[model samples]
Target: MKNEYTDHAWDERDPSPWLALYLDQSTPLPDEVKAAWLRDCSSSSRQFFLPLVRPMARVSMILIQLLKIFLPKRWSHSMLLHRLLALSMNRFVSPEANWLIMRHFHLGSQVLAFVAANAPVAVTATPLTPMVIDDVKDELFLRHDLNLFNFVIRLNKALRTENKELLPVPEPDFSMLRQPDLRLEDMPRGKLNLLDLQSAIEIYTPVYQLLLTDNDFWRASNSLQLDETVAIYCAKILASPEHLVLLNNKHPLVPMTTLYAAYRLVLHGLSSEMLHSLLMRMARGEIPVPARELAKMHKAAEAVAAEESLAP
Candidate 1:
């Protein structure tokens, strides 16, 4: 479905080539061509997931604490599987962690059967765009907070293990709270403009569904799509630092990804807003960032930017 050849990091100002390689292409992906694709996806999954385990697991712990505010231990434990799953997928944690999650969910016994039945066998076939996102989006939306929290946790895992080369030092700036030209909530639907939150979900929601249904092999298949989304998200948030501070539990995915993305953007002076609107749409829950963290991030970005500008 997406191109596998292009290399676009999160800070790259122009993510078109990166997006084209993964999102716009329709070239056939038979097994041979798909092999490389799968490898890249594996690499991406590893990159994104490794850094997030501890953070998300901790977040899960805090959530359990918060859940205690309104619910009892039994109910919280009952939904624990969903929580772990949400974090595992959203945070992009390692496959092994997903395995551990399955064990935690008590899905260990069924995992093999699920993988065997769902994973594609070795045979020649045309690999169209994966449908993982479509199959699971509604389920994810229903458990919106868990999903959003999971994304943040997964990001932590990725950051923990990312290569030094992939980490970019961001420019310092006090911009996370800066007002945008237009609020997404205020956008009009009938006008001919870029897609708003609803439209973005309509267009991108299916990707995660596809991811859910994909057998490990197929999971391996759509690796590029995962990376593209991450890179695109990272670049967009850095250019619009204010988006990060504005996140809260109410707008979970948007703010969490934006927050993680801003961190990513800081690693490099490169940045873009191409995906900001799309991210805003994905915000199905709230995300309240601490004011102190917000201030620190701005200072970090501004400092990094100034350093880069002066670099020989």
Candidate 2:
């Protein structure tokens, strides 16, 4: 991979520049229009209102959790009570925190898909160890937070540039960022009973379905330019032996692997139905290796072997 493509994967200084660029270019709107759209979507004002309601939301969440303990396992998993509690507590939390709770599942799913697509050799060679799953979960959470922070910063900057009166957004009080402990704790743990690949797909499908219903994600998936950029990046990472090793070894910091792969498929013009079918097949170990992709991996491995042979 070229420096530009590979550097962004590890560089934390400027979070998700590639994704940000994709976002900026994909949604073509004039400055004023963008600012207006952001203003309408802004939840900054909710911060001021949150203090008044925070205590109540916290109490409500606690009661819900207590009720869950007394409920049957099936009843507890219904998500009805959870959804209600989340709705009530939503305004009391940081947008990033809420997103982490609500959308991180989807984000993690996308990351898994990327890994499965771009690092097939590594994925097939390695067992899906707990450490690997944890790494994926952590990356998903980090990317979710980074992307949220970047979006807010960019929105504010654009608003300021347009001379729009900034929304009076308060600094997030991390203490108030609470969700159900059970849910939060479960994010890092993959299902252990199933076969490794089956478990990954099972973990991902619910969230993937959730994302399919999300208007924002749907719109982004439709962005041809963004998809192409992401696809190109995925291809680069797929070709990088170091990246393959990191992914196979479950490196702690392999960022945005899944998101890039999901976008690549989206950009490659797979319909949702087709994409889902592909994921199912991939998970079941039924996906045939594309000759070109396989050839690229073989060639890269040969180059590595040759380089090692020459080394003292």
Candidate 3:
């Protein structure tokens, strides 16, 4: 009923300011990280977007054709306005199959909204177009990518199911902190003996589980140590295309990205909240390091490998 919340929708024509503020938090976001992320978004754009994007691009023209062919002569060309509004709203937030439905509704809403705004009261007794109107709404609803929507919806539901209180991180597992000899140079000198491998596993299980199921999760993987096997797997997944799917999964990319950001943060001895916003940014497509982070890690691994190879 009330249109007040519409401004907050992703379809807002000017999301730049919001996006900028959003990215600022993720800032100190390294250039290598930034470049890596842009590359990933670009690749995703090509793979998942371009195919169906064009049809929506020409939705207005298609709407004209539909109205001409299907509508009654007396109804003004504006009858399809409602569909346009609905579509635009849907497309802004939805992903996957439901996108088609949103596209159609956007074109149709323009006509319907126009009619609703301008149509005058009419006393004419001719039967009203009941079936046609219902069909339009029904079709839009049917075309919705319900599965994808449901998944996202369920994810948000799950997150909100609990309070906003932060989950307590367990003690670090000291026994598993043994850093391999090769990392002695590149990595800062630290007590490898202090890390709580088991605790880290418990804290990071959600992320590791997602990586296990993702096919591309290992593409960017770089093994660091036996104890960090899960972290390496996670790095692989984040660098892989599977990141996109996982981002859209039940836990959503928000938490996953946040976890990775936190892992990096922990290494820096930074506060966990340092990554809280960054995780939100990544979920909204501001992933830092992205593939490049994986590349860096890979390079580090290679450097270690090379050193090991030349060992006397």
Candidate 4:
């Protein structure tokens, strides 16, 4: 299992060894046990039922807009109203749904930040046009024309740079108005490496920073592994009167816990099984052993076993 752990550690750049453990077929569970475990762990049910809530969400949005007419603009945009609406929304949906929704927004913002930082010229040059969507289409039809435009512009610029080594004339399909799908057939025939796009998408420094600075985040992450020592440490931190008061006051637009889950999924491309396992552990509030402590224990046990064998 340990060998399997190291083998699959970087399979998804997942820091959690337990995730790798779950993925390793060498330690297969019985069908019934696996099914039960999956049932306990899975948030895919929220995804399954998400479409059903779209109409309700739309109605809620419309009602909120109508009510805004009676309320002052300041009141309508106030954090109080935002919190009320979020609380109401939370009542109707699972935590998974909230996580999924916020995750999308978080990822979209990350993409925009990436583009702004790496392709400033492309983002600045690209015209921001509003995308039209059919009202009858699914709620997922939400589009960001500006972001898409910037991405295409950047892609084309990269292609042009690559083209300098190849063809004299730029590909006719590469136009600002009509962005080709990022497919091999649609793209210009060249050594157009998407290293920039990859880098932009994979950047999780902000999320990492959040985890590093936050005791609650560490507590939550530790919960995934059900680590008693970390849990005790977290309890001591949380037991502080100042910390308890802060936690009571910490009402965020998006739950930091959900944000962490989403960040891990989006940034690391965590597999569905691993995600399910993580969500389950998080839900149960189990804190795992931190990797450092686990490594130390393993080394100590190995030394003790070696000494016993030498005595024999």
Predictions in order: lDDT: 0.31, 0.33, 0.30, 0.31
lDDT of 4 by residue, 1-312 (tens): 012323434545446545544555542232222332322234343334334443444444345445545654334122332343344323433332333333333333332332233331333332222121111022221223233434445655764776621111111111121211122122112232211211211222222222222332233332222112212222232221221221221222233433233233332222222222322332244533233344567789999999999994
Cα distance off (Å), candidate 1, residue 230: 10
Span of ten consecutive residues with least summed lDDT in model 3: 218-227
Best by TM-score: 2
Q: List the candidates' TM-scores in order.
A: 0.20, 0.24, 0.20, 0.23
Q: Pick the candidate with the highest lDDT.
A: 2
List, in order, the clash count of every candidate structure.
Answer: 64, 1, 34, 10
User: Which wins on lDDT, candidate 1 or candidate 2?
Assistant: 2
> What root-mean-square deviation over C-alphas does model 2 reach?
22.7
Q: Give the TM-score of candidate 2.
A: 0.24
| Model 3 regions more than 4 Å off | 1-138, 146-287
Better of 3 and 4 by lDDT: 4
Instruction: Assess candidate 1 and give its TM-score to the true structure.
Output: 0.20
Taking every candidate in turn, the Cα RMSD to the unseen true structure, in Å, is 21.6, 22.7, 27.3, 25.2
Would you list the clashing residue pairs of candidate 2?
A: 111-258
**What is the lDDT, from 0 to 100, of the residue 65 in candidate 1?**
41
Clashing pairs in 4: 222-287, 222-288, 223-286, 223-287, 225-287, 225-288, 226-287, 226-288, 227-287, 227-288
Candidate 1: worst-modelled 10 consecutive residues by lDDT: 122-131
Error of 1 at 264 (Å): 26
Q: Candidate 3's residue-wise lDDT over 30-71, tens digit each?
A: 332233222322344434554444344334324443444554
